[model samples]
Target: MNFGTKAVHAGVTPDPSTGAIMTPIYQTSTYVQESPAKHKGYAYARGANPTRNALQKSIAALEDGKFGICFSSGMGATDAVIKLLAPGDEVITSNDLYGGSYRMFRKIYEKFGIKFHFIDLTDVNNITPFLNEKTKLLWLETPSNPLMRITDIKALTTIAKKNNMLVAVDNTFASPYLQNPLALGADIVMHSVTKYLEWP
Candidate 1:
């Protein structure tokens, strides 16, 4: 299906109980089970919810990715990505990225020993001096927050991959409708759905 169709129906199904056209909002925090250990896919709202699952499916479909995971906020998503690294690992990212992300990198993770190199990713070559065995991730924010500077996702991913670095793009500005970073060789793609992907 095309983008328009996928946006409407990709990860959604008619309500099985009521035959409702869209997945109903599953508002309960807990699910009833036949036994203490037996239940359908969902058990707790904190763990999973049908509504959120549908949204994740739609997002993954739009991005041409195999899976998508939702977070309470964009920073939550970024934190999860950064947690994939250990102390002494390094990340190379655009200096023009979202302010909240910058602060998180500097204040929170830096103290943990994950060095962040904030550089002009718009030139791609600026990333070279930072490349090394310790560099584990290449983070990009296309049409970067505030400044609206566009980074060359494919070009940067190519160089990053050569050095065995995982690439992640914060696609909030461009959104999946305009750009699919995974297709450009990024290992991960993140979106603040409350931004461009918000339902009308």
Candidate 2:
């Protein structure tokens, strides 16, 4: 099915017990088990919840990825990805990025020994000099916040791949509707669902 069809029906189906068409929110904290080793899918809310799983599965399907993990907030997701970089690993990122991301990378991650260098990603040439073995991640924020500057994802991905670096794109502005970074060769794509996906 196309993206539009998948968006509407990919992660949800009729409930087997009640025959409800919409995906019901599984709001409980825990699920009962027939035995200690054998269970009925869910164990705890923190690890997994039916509602959250639906959302995560939908997102992963939309992005054409194998897995999806939802977090309490966008920063939570960002922090999780950054954690993949060990202490003293370098990250090459855009100079004009979201303030929250900047704080996370510069203030928080730096304290943990993760170093970041912000450069003009629009001019792919400027980023080339910074690519090296130590660089673990290439963080891209296209159509950047406040400034709305667009970067060439394909070009950046090429550079990142050459150095065997992971490429993460902040897709909040353009969104999956306007942009799909994974199709353009990005390793990871993030969104601020609170903004366009959920806000009224």
Candidate 3:
């Protein structure tokens, strides 16, 4: 299917109950079961929410990724990624960082001992000097927030792969319609889904 068609239909299953074309929100905080362990996939809101699942699946498909994870906010998603690293781990990212991302790194994670190196990532080779044994992830933001600097995701991911590091691209600026970092060798793609995700 084309991008437009995929955007409209990917990950959307016909509603089993009402036959609605789009996935309906499963809004309840709790689900009842016949027994303690026997029930539909959902058990609680905190663990699994069908509405969130549908949205996540949709975004994943849109980004050409196999699976997707959603968060309460963009910062929550970034926090989850940061939590995957240990105290001595390092991250190399664009100097034109998003405000929320900067806060997460400087105010929150830095105190925990994770070091961050922010540099001009416009030229992929510029990252070579910053690469080191402690590096765990390369966080890139294309069409970066505020200033809108575009980083080459494919080039950066290639270098990251050689060093055995994970590459995550903040796709909030381009959105899935404009670019897909997963298809370009990025391990993870993030979208804020707050500004450009228009709803009918």
| Prediction 3 TM-score vs. true | 0.95
Q: In model 3, which runs have C-alpha deviations exceeding 4 angstroms?
A: 197-200
Worst 10-residue lDDT window, candidate 2: 191-200
What's the CA error at residue 179 for candidate 2, in Å? Answer: 0.8
TM-scores for every candidate against the unseen true structure = 0.96, 0.94, 0.95
Count residue pairs with overlapping backbones in model 3.
0
Which runs in model 2 stand beyond 4 Å of their true positions? 197-200
> Compared with the true structure, what per-residue lDDT tens digits does model 2 show for residues 39-83?
767788897787888889888888887778888888898999999
- Model 1, range 61-99, lDDT digits (tens) per residue? 999999999999999999999999999999999888899
lDDT of 3 by residue, 10-65 (tens): 88888777998898888889888889978888788998987798888888888999
Please give the clash total of every predicted structure, in order: 0, 0, 0
In model 3, what are the clashing residue pairs, if there are any?
Answer: none
